[model samples]
Target chain A: MAISIVVTSGKGGVGKTTTTANLGTGLALQEKKVCLIDMDIGLRNLDVVLGLENRIIYDIIDVIEGRAKLHQALIKDKRFDDKLYLLPAAQHADKTAINGEQVKAIIDELRSDFDYILIDCPAGIESGFQNAIAGADEAIVVATPEISAVRDADRVIGLLEKAEMAPPKLVINRIRSKMMQDGEVLDIDEITTHLAIELLGIVVDDDTVIRSSNQGEPVILDPKNQAAQGYRNIVRRILGETVPLMTIHEEKKSFFAKLFGKKK
Target chain B: MSTKNVKLKGTKEGYTIVLHDVASFEEILIDLEELLLNISKQNNASTEISVHVDTENRLLSDEQLAKVYQLVEQHSTMKIGKVQTNVLTKEAATLWKESENVATLVTTVRNGQVVTMPGDVMLLGSIHQGGTLKAAGNIYLFGELKGIVHAGYLGDEDKVVFAKFNHDAQVRIGEQVQIIEGKGKNEPLEDTTFAYVNDLHILSFDQLDQIRAIKPKLGNQTGGLL
Candidate 1:
C-alpha cells in the first residue's frame, strides 16, 4: 500500500508548500512514483512552485466534482515523466467546495498507482486542512524556528490528536544556526520540546531555496546545495532509512560571518 | 380584547409554548397536545418532546404535572423526558456547587501491559499495546483501551472508570473483581465499557447487556490485580 502524507502547518508562510514540492521531487528522484496533491483551493501555488503553472488543465475540485477524470486532471512532471505528477487545486473555488469524503475517494484511486502521495495542506485549521488530512496515513508538521510558528504548530498538533490522527512528525524549517548559537533564535531542540513530536529534518536558511523557487526548481534537484541535501535527507528518512542530519555550519560563511568574526 | 394569544418561541436549549387567557388549564393542555401531535406527524421523527407550563403565576400540583406529562406522551413520536420546576430549593442551590468538580476517570490497557497512567492518575496520550494502567480513582481513555485496567486498585471500591473503546481487557475496580474473559469478540459495537467496585471486587457490564451475571463467590476480599 502507498503511504499518503499530509504536509501541514497551522500558521501561514511556514514553508508547507515548499516542503511538499521538495519532498515529492526528492522521492521521485530516488525512482519512487510520487504524486503531489495541492489542496489549498483558491490560493493554489504548488503548480507554480513545481514550474508547471501553464500546463494545468484540470484541478482537484474538477476531479472531485466529476467535471474531469482523475487521469485528466493529473499533470505529469516533464522532468520525471511518469514518475512525478501534480494534482493541482482549483483557483476559483473556496475550501468548502470539497470535503473529507471527496479527498479520500481521490486518494483511494491514486493509492494503487503511486508509491507516495504528498498532500500540501492549506495554512489554517479549516475545511481544507481536514480534507487534506482525511486520507493521510501519516502527517508532517512544518514550522519555522520562531515563537509564533512554533505556538501555532503546537495547536495544530493538538488538533491532529483530537482528530485521532497519530502523532505527526515535525520538520523545523528555515533555521539559521548562527543566530541559534548566538541565542538570538530558537534552536531545533527548543522547538521540538514545545511541539513534542518526532523530529524529521531541518532545512537551513539558504538563499538557494528562494532562487530555486523562482526558477520553478526545488533545491533537492541540486546535488551540491546544502539545503537540497537536507530535503534529500528527509526523503531518505521517510523511506525508513536512517540518514545523518545535514551539517548547517559546514556551508561557506556569508560576508556577515567574517565581519562579526563569529563561527557558526 | 377577547382575542386569544398563543406564542411559540425557540430558545437556545429547546422550544417554549405559551398560552394566554385560556378558558382553563384543561383547554390549554388539549390545544398543546394537538400542536405537538401535528408537529410529530409532520416531521416523521421519533424524538422525545418536552413542554414547560406556567399558569397564572401558580405552582403546578402533582396532578397537573401528571396531566402535562401524559399529554405529551400521548403523541406517538414524542414523550416527556424531563420536567424542570421553577421553584428553587436549598439542596438544588448546593447541587450546582457539588457538580462543579465531579470528574469521570478512565483507564485503558492494551495487550496486557500498562502503557499509560490509569484514569485515577492524570497522564498524557493513549495507552499503547502491551501496556497496563491502574487508578485509585476514576479512569478515562480518549482512545481505545485494549489492555488490563485496575481502577480503585487500593480497594476503595467506589471509583468508577469508563473507556471509549473497550476490547476484552481485564478490569478491576476494588477487592471484588470478576474476570470476564468470555466476552466474545465483536460483542461491543459502540466500544465503550464502564467498571465500578461492587461488594469489593470489580464488576463490569456492557451497556447493551440487559442481564448482568453477578457471581456471589466474587467478593471484596480478593485484592485487585495490578
Candidate 2:
C-alpha cells in the first residue's frame, strides 16, 4: 500500500507547496511511483509550481463530484517518465466543496497504484486542513525560522498529535544561516526544541527556489543547490534511508574552541 | 414553657437564633414556632426584627434552609439575616479543597494552548508565545514563561503570578493587564519577578522578597513553617 503523507503548515506563505512539489519530484527521481495531490481548493497553486498548469484538463473536484474519472484528472509530468503524477485542485471550487470522507476515498483508491502519495495541504487549521490530513497516514509540518511561522507550526503539531497520526515530522525551511548565527532569528536547535517533534530536514533560504517556481520548475530538479540537497535528504529519510543533517554554515572553529565549546 | 431545642439570644449586633445540632427536626420546628409566636404576640406588629440563624456544626440541605426561612417568615415579622453553618456539603467541601491546594502542571503549554487551574498552579513546563496560563488563584512558575499568564482569573484581585520575567509576555492579575513590551524581546529582565495587583488596582511587577510582605499567607497555608 502507498504511504500517504500530508504536507501542512498552519501559517500562510511558509513554503508548504514548494516542499510538497520538491519532495514529490525527489521521490520520483528515486524510481518510485509518486502521486501529488493539491488539496488547496479555491486557491490552487501546486499545479503552477509543478509547471503542469496547461496540461490539467480535469481537477480533483471533477473526480470527487463524479464529473471525471480519477485517471482523467491526474496529469503526468513529462520529465518523470510515468513516475510522477499530479491531481490538481479545482480553482473554481471552495474548500467546503469536498469533505474529509471524499478525500479519504480518493486517497484509498490511489493507494494500490502508487508507491507514495503526497497531499499538499493548505495553510490554516480550517476544514481544508482537516480534509487534507484526514486521508494521510503520516504528516510533514513545514515551518520557517521566523517566530510567527514557528508559533503556527507549534499549533499545527498540537492538532496533528490530537489527530493521532504517526508522530508528525518537522521541516524547518527558509533558514538563513547568517540571521541564525547572529541571533536575529530563531536557530535550528531552538526551533526543533520548541516544536518538540522529529526533525526531518532543514532547507536554506535559496533565491533560486522562487525563481525556479516562477518558471514552473521545482528547484529539486537541480542537484547542486543547497535547498535541493535538503529536499533530497528529506526524501531519502522518508524512504527509510539514514542521512545526516547537512551543515548550513561551514564556519571552522579553533581546536581549543571546539573542545571547550562556545558559550550560547 | 420555655423552648427545648431552639434558643434565642441577643448579642451586641442583633438577635441570634441558635438551632441545636442534635435536636430532632420536628421538635425543633415545633419549639421554634412556639418561641416565634410568643415573640410576635409580645412585640408590636410595626417592629420587624432580623435575626441571624446559627446552625452550629449542622449541615442543612437547600430544602431544609428554605423551610427554616419559610417558618420564620410565617410565624413572625423576624427576617433571617443569613444562615451560618460550621460544616459544609461534600460538593462544596471538594470545591473548597480544590481551590485551597496548589495544582501541579508538568506539560509544555504550546502556542494557542490555554491551561487553566482551579487554584494556584505550579508549572514545570514552558509556555510558548500565543499560549496562555490562567489560574483562579496565584501562579507559581518553575519553567520558562514566554506567553500570557493570568492570575485571579475569576476576578479575586489579590492573587499574583511569580515567574522569571520574559519581556515578550503579558501579565494579567485579576482585571488588570500589564504588557511587558517596553523591554527588549527575548530578554530576561529579572531572575525572579512577580506580577501582582497593587493597592491602586493596577498590575505591578516586583522582586521575590516583596511577595512575603505582599501576600503573607502564600506558601504558608498551614500557618507554620514545616
Candidate 3:
C-alpha cells in the first residue's frame, strides 16, 4: 500500500511545489517506487520543475477521464536508481473540471503499485484544495517565516483537521536565521508555537532551490547544498526515522565574539 | 366610511386603522389607504396626525408592514404611532438571534487586510505590518501583534488590548493612543504585554502576575479558543 500525502500551504509561493518535487525525489533515491501527482491542474508547474515537461503525451485529466491508460500517462524519471514517476496535471483545463471524488478514485488506482504517492495541492480553500486532499491520508504544511505565510498555514491546518486527516506536519521553508536574530522576522520556536503543529523540517533560505527549479531539476539532486540535506531529513522523518533538525544560528558570530570581548 | 377590508377605530391617543387577516394583500392595502385618504379629507387639517396600526391576530411580513406604513405616509393627516404583531408564533424566534459581537482570527492578518469587528476580537496569529485590527470590545492576541490595533473602536474606552509579542505596533483604545516608538527594545519588561486605560492613561504592562495581583478591571471580555 502507498503512503499518500498532500503537500499544501494556504498562501501561494511558499515552496509547496518545490517541497513536493524534492521529497518525492528524496524518497525515490532511497529505492522506493515514488509517484509525484501534480494536483495544481491548469497551473501545473511540477513537470517544469522536475524537467519532465517534454515527456508528457498524456496527463492526470486524461487518465481520470478514461482518455488514456494509467501506464500511458505516468512519466518515468531515470535519475534515481529505483524509479520516480510523475502524473502531470492538464494545462488546458480549469480546476473545477475535476472534483474530489474523481481525484480520490485516481489515487486509489495508483496506490497498489507505488511505495509513496505525494500530491501537490493547489493553494487556497477552494475546490482545488479539497480535490487534492480528498484521497490524502497525511499532509505536510509548508510555510515561510513571514507572518502572512504562517497565518495561512494555520487556516490550512484547521481545514485539514476538519477533513479528518491525521494531524499535519509543518515544514518551515525559506528560513533566514540572520534576519530572525535581528528581530526582522520570526524564528523556528516562535513559528512552531504559534502554529501549534509538529514540525517536520526547515529548509534554509537558499538560491539553489530556485536555480534548480529553473533548470528543470529539484534541489535535492545537489547533495552539497544545506537545503538539500533538509529535504533528505524530511524524507527520513516521514519514513518513521528520528532526525535532529539542521542547526540555524545567528550567522556564527562566535569567532568575532571572543575577540570582541563578548562573553561566550 | 367603513370598508369590508379596513376597520378604523378611535383610540384614546388618536385613530386606529386595522386590516382584516383573511383579505387579499392588495385589497387590504388599497382599502386601508382609501380609509386614510377619507380621514384626511374629513379633517382638512395638518398633514401629520398620530395614529396606531393594528394587524389583528396576525404576523405581517416586512413587505406588508412597510405597505401599511407607506399607506399612512401617503395620507396628509396620519402619522404612525405603533405597529403590533399580536398573537405571533415562531416569527420572532427565527427572525432574530443573539447579536454578532465576536470576531475570530485563525490566520495571519495579511498586509492590506483591514479587519473591523464589533464586540470582542481574538487573534490566533500575528497581524502583518499593513493590516489593522479594530474592535468595539476587547482585543486579545494569542500570537504576535505587529500591526496597528484600535480597541473599544465603538468608543468604549474600557476595552483592553493584549499581545504576546510586539513589532513597533501602534495601539489606540478609547480616546488615548500609544505608539511603541524606536526599535521596540523597551516593551513593558514582560513576556506577555497588555494595554488598557489606567486613570485616563493608556498604560502598558508585561507584569501579568502583578496586574492579576492588583486586580485591574478588564471589562466585557468575549472570545478565545473554545
Candidate 4:
C-alpha cells in the first residue's frame, strides 16, 4: 500500500511546490517507486521543477475528465529510470475542473503501484486545498520563518487537523538561521510553537534551491547543497530513521579557502 | 413603533413580525400579542401578522412555526403569510453553532478569510494578519489576536473585544477602534487585555478588575463596519 502525502501551504510563495518536488526526488533516491502529482491546476510548475516539463502529453485534468488514462498521462522522471514519475497538472484547466472525488479516485488507482505519492497542493484553503488533500494518508505543511508565512501555516495546520489527515507534519522552509539568531524572524522553535504541530524537517535558506530550479532539477539531487542535505534528512526521517536536523552553520570563507575556492 | 421591543416590518405582501434574535420565541410571541392588542384598541386597521420565523443558521421547524401561527390567530385578527428564509445562512449558522460554540473556533481564520458570525464569537485560537472576525455580539479571544476584529456588529457599542494576552491587535467596537502598539511580551501592556467603546474613544484595560472601576462615559454607540 502506497502512502500518499500532500504538500500544502495556506500562503502562496512559501516553497510548497519545491518541498514536494525535492521530497519526491529524495524518496526516489531511496529506490522507492515514487510518483509526484502536481495538483496546482491552472498554475502548474512541478513538472518543470522535476525537469520533465517537455515530456508531458496529458495532465491530471485530462485523466480525470476521461481524455487520457492515468499511466498514459504520467511522465517518467527524465533522470530516474523507473524510480520516479510525475503526473503534471493542466495549465488551462481551472482548479475545480477536477473535483475532490475524482482526485481521490485517481489517487486510489495509483496506490497499489507506487511506494509513495506526493501531491503538490495549490495555495489557499479552498476547493483546490480540499481536492489536493483528499485521499492523502498524511499532509506536509510547508512554511517559512516569516510571521505571515507562519501564521498561514498555523491556519493550514488547523485545517488539516479538521480534515483529520494523520496529524500533518510541518516543514519550515527557507529559514535564515542568521536572521533567527538576530531575532529578526521567528526561529524553528517559535514556528513550531505557533503552529503546534510535529516538526518534520527544516530547510535552511540556500541559494542553490533557485539555481537548481532554473535548471529544472530538484535541489535534493545536489549532494553538496545544504538544502539538499535538509531534504535527504527529511526523506530518511520519513523512512522512520531518526535523522537530526541539518545544522545551518554560518557560511564562513577562510582567507586561503576563498583565495583558492573553485570558480563556478 | 416597536412596542416593548416587538418589531413589525411593512413588507410588500403585508407586515412581517420581526423577531428578536436574542429573545426567546415565547417572549417575542407574548410581546407581539400585546402589540397587536394595543393596535386593535387604538383603531380597526386591517393589518396582517405573518411570522418571519426563518432565521439564519437555525430556522423554526414547521411544527414550531405552526404554534406561532395558531397563537397569532387566537390572539389577533391577523392572517399568516408564507414564511421564507435564507436557507444557506441558516444551514451554515446552525451547523457551526451546534458543532462548536462562541469560545471554540474549530479552525484558525486565515488571511483573506472573513468570518462574519451571527452571535458572539469566542476564538480559542489566533487570527492571521489580514483575517477578520465580525459578529453581531462581543468577541472573546483566548489566544493571540493579530488580525482585525469588529464586535457589536449590529451597532451595540456596549459590546467588547477581549484578548487573553496583550499583542499588537486592532479591535473595533461599533465605531470605536483601538490598537495596542509595541510588543505585548513585556512592560505596561503585560497581562490580559480587554477593550470597549466608551464615549467617543475606545477604552482598553489591562486587568479584568479595571473594568469595574472606570465609569463609562456617553458617546456615539452606532454605525461602524470593518
Best by DockQ: 2
How well does each candidate superpose onto the true structure, as a TM-score? Answer: 0.56, 0.78, 0.61, 0.69
Evaluated with lDDT, which candidate comes out highest? 2
Better of 1 and 4 by DockQ: 4
Write the residue-wise lDDT of candidate 3 on B39-105 in tens digits.
7778887756777778887787888788778777777556788886466566444222211344676
DockQ, cand. 2: 0.52
> Between prediction 1 and prediction 3, which has the larger DockQ?
3
lDDT by residue for model 4 over B1-41, one digit each (tens)? Answer: 46654676776666676655667777867887787677667
Q: Where is model 4 chain A poorest over a 10-residue stretch in terms of lDDT?
A: A244-253
Across A1-264, the per-residue lDDT of candidate 4 in tens digits comes to 799999998999999889999999999989999999999999999988778888889998889888899999989885777999999999998987878899899999999999999999999989999999987999999999988788788777767876876989999999887887787888888778667678999998889999899899899988888889899999999999998777775767777778999542
TM-score of chain A of 3: 0.94
Please give the fraction of native interface contacts (Cα pairs under 8 Å between A and B) kept by each candidate: 0.00, 0.67, 0.00, 0.20
Better of 1 and 2 by TM-score: 2
The backbone clash count of each candidate, in order, is 25, 0, 2, 3
> What is candidate 2's CA lDDT for residue B191?
66
Better of 1 and 3 by lDDT: 3
Q: On residues A1-264, what C-alpha lDDT tens digit does candidate 3 reach at each position?
A: 998999999999999999999999999988889999999999999999999999899998998788999889999997875489999999999898899999898899999999999999998879999999999999999999998898788778877877899989999999887887787998898889777789999999899889999998899989899899999999999999999988977445577796896766
* Candidate 1 residue runs with Cα over 4 Å from true position: A250-264, B1-121, B124-226
Model 2 C-alpha lDDT per residue in residues A90-191, reported as the tens digit of each score: 999899999999999999999999999999999899999999999999999999999889989989887887788898999999999888888889899988
